[model samples]
Target chain A: MKHNSYFDGKVQSLELHTENGVATVGVITPGQYTFGTSTQEKMVITAGSLRVKLPDQDWQTVMSGEFFVVDKNVSFVVEAEQDVAYLCYYF
Target chain B: MKHNSYFDGKVQSLELHTENGVATVGVITPGQYTFGTSTQEKMVITAGSLRVKLPDQDWQTVMSGEFFVVDKNVSFVVEAEQDVAYLCYYF
Candidate 1:
């Protein structure tokens, strides 16, 4: 298993293998962070909600059970008013 | 934000405030771990699954979206075949 800590540990994730591909379960604290993807990413919210702003897109709220996709080599901003739990898949 | 690492960092959690109370979102590695609680806990599986052995009870599998409760001052054993994501409410 791989453990990742980002933004001075405000965001953390654990790497896992899933049938679809490699995935990560992570938590984001109450703050905003920018992420750049190396592969096409599908991010699913499992707890709380995240306000996201993708490149060339308006900010949106992704609630629990909702998901968003980001193209490879793109950057996105995610804001968490409260703690948010998420699972992200890389393809 | 509070971060907890247990079992030499095989399991990790982040503290959060919920409507019900204080809670933690965490991930369990693929192994068996023993946990002791200082407060009553309701653990909800959010991803993958957990096989749990509560005090004086037989082992049971709790899948995603399912929950199990444990009283305060008790100990339990949990096993994960894959990385399992969970939210635990403490009261």
Candidate 2:
């Protein structure tokens, strides 16, 4: 297990092995952020929500229990009004 | 946010704020452990499952998307056969 911190500890993640494959459970503090992905990521909102802007798309709210996918080798944007918890699976 | 490690890091948690109150997201390795709570806890399984024995009750399985509540000032037992991720809300 590994714990990774990003954006000066405002965002942190714990790596774990899941039935679906390698995944991370992370928390993001209230702020706006842009993330780049190496693998295609399936971002599942476990608690709270994320306002996301995918490539060539409009901003959308992804609520708890909902998910959004990000393609590999692209940078995407996310905004959080409050602390958000998510589980991301890389494929 | 604080990251708390327990059981020699076999169980670790990251603290966060949520609409429900103060909460933590954590991961547990494959093992059995007992925990004592100071506050009433709402334990939600985010990934995998927990074999839990609440106080005097028999062991039962708590699957993902399912939750179990533990009373304050009590000790409970939980066993994981694989890596399990969960969110615990304290009230």
Candidate 3:
């Protein structure tokens, strides 16, 4: 029952329970933001697209129905060209 | 730039801009709630599942990647077993 809203309310998330693990479904407005994670996160793009720059990796555009993973304790940058909807599973 | 959270923060949504129309990406906790709409809405389930009862329609379960529409000025009931993530487009 975690409802976290950040970045001036431009980004918001709802905690979810899954069979495998804990996940979050969130939405991001058109902007760039940095994120830090405590656990390995698998982020799936459910709508729109995200321009992501992972650690030591080039910027990549993740589209809808696509997914990307961020290592635990890692920080990343993401830019949304449009309103981006994502589901992130923590492991 | 609308971030509206309802039902004691159990439900949250972020306004989105799409090519076709305005949409909302939101998440519902494990509860039953009634929603009133001012415009026609096309709700798409992106993750988890939702039990929805539209006007004059039976209680229907909408799974991930599925969708349902509600007429303008109508009200509907939706229940989530787990956490339900949805994208709603308004027309």
DockQ of each: 0.43, 0.73, 0.53
- Between prediction 2 and prediction 3, which has the larger lDDT? 2
Backbone clashes for every candidate come to 0, 0, 0
Tens digits of lDDT, candidate 2, A1-91: 7999999999999988999999888899999999999999999998898899999999999999999999999999999999999988999
TM-score of chain A of 3: 0.98
Model 2 chain B poorest ten-residue lDDT run = B10-19
lDDT of each: 0.88, 0.93, 0.88
Q: How would the candidate models be sorted by TM-score, starting from the highest?
A: 2, 3, 1
- Considering summed lDDT, which 10 consecutive residues are worst modelled in model 3 chain B? B12-21
Candidate 2 chain A: worst 10 consecutive residues by lDDT? A16-25
Can you rank all candidates by DockQ, best first? 2, 3, 1
Taking chain B only, the TM-score of every model is 0.98, 0.98, 0.97
Write candidate 1's Cα lDDT for A9-80 as tens digits. Answer: 889877777667788878888899999999999999877899999999999999988999999999999999
Which residue pairs does candidate 2 place in steric collision?
Answer: none
> Can you tell me which runs of candidate 3 are displaced by over 4 Å?
none
